[model samples]
Target: MLTVQEIRELIKVVDESAIDEFTYETSGETVTMKKSGSKAVAAVPDNGAHTDHPVDPVKNSQPNIQVEQTEVSSSDEKPIVETTADFDHEIVSPMVGTFYASPNPESDSYVTVGSKVEKDTVVCIVEAMKLFNEIEAETTGEITEILVEDGELVEYGQPLFRVKKK
Candidate 1:
């Protein structure tokens, strides 16, 4: 079995490099890393099947991706013109783990919608293998959206919060 530190190092290397996919196998255990869209996924084998989990990987800044949706008018008129809008900066999970909105159940979440944050501010916690890791908002902004519920399982690179940059 690979140590947690080893896995973290691999994730860091893969995240920083331009390589799109990577895999490693040893002693019947296999780990695969792949980048898709803006998300990076790491998979490990369980009973001959691969299960994806989040791992500690640094986020790489990329240009905003725009998606368009078309809606028909209620009167059956022509479709409205497409409008372009920029997306907020996404705060992603650094590892696969259970998301906790607060330090404890009784505590308020680190941040909520409209909550302003600095680059070093901790926004949430992710628990993996009994280890609780604090996640930070690497960009200064106001929280615009929280993508996951407390106690939910989050995959590596999964967006946890969307921040409207200051």
Candidate 2:
């Protein structure tokens, strides 16, 4: 069995390199890693097979791997354009995790619509891997809208709050 640190290191290597997919199999365990945009997903599937000892090299052969590339048409792609014209600045999430509006469930929210904030003001918290990371507003402005709700899952670069410049 692979350790958590080993799996994390493998993910980091795959993310930094140009490789889109990676697969490894040993005994009864198989691990697959794939990159989609800026995010990476790792999956381990169960084939209902288990082996205590390693298979003989001469008896067992490695499976052939094939890589396929797909092209997207111009019509199939849709560009993302912000429709709100009132907000001049947006507070975006720095990592993929669960967004929290306040430090605790019973506490009041950090900011709301019409709340003025400075560059270093913490707007929310993103919890990832048992770590609570406070997300700060990198711009000085008044929050015009809250883009994400409390306890919502957010992706990296996802807009969390819309702010109107002072």
Model 1 residue 35 lDDT score = 65
* Tens-place lDDT digits, model 2, residues 36-119: 676555554322221222111111111221111112111122222466558888887655456788877777899989899998
TM-scores of all predicted structures: 0.56, 0.61
How much is 93 displaced in model 1, in angstroms?
0.8
Per residue, candidate 1 scores C-alpha lDDT tens digits across 47-132 of 21112332343343232221111111111112222223344698887665577888777778889998999998889887654456
Error of 1 at 44 (Å): 6.1
TM-score of 2: 0.61
Q: Highest lDDT, which number?
A: 1
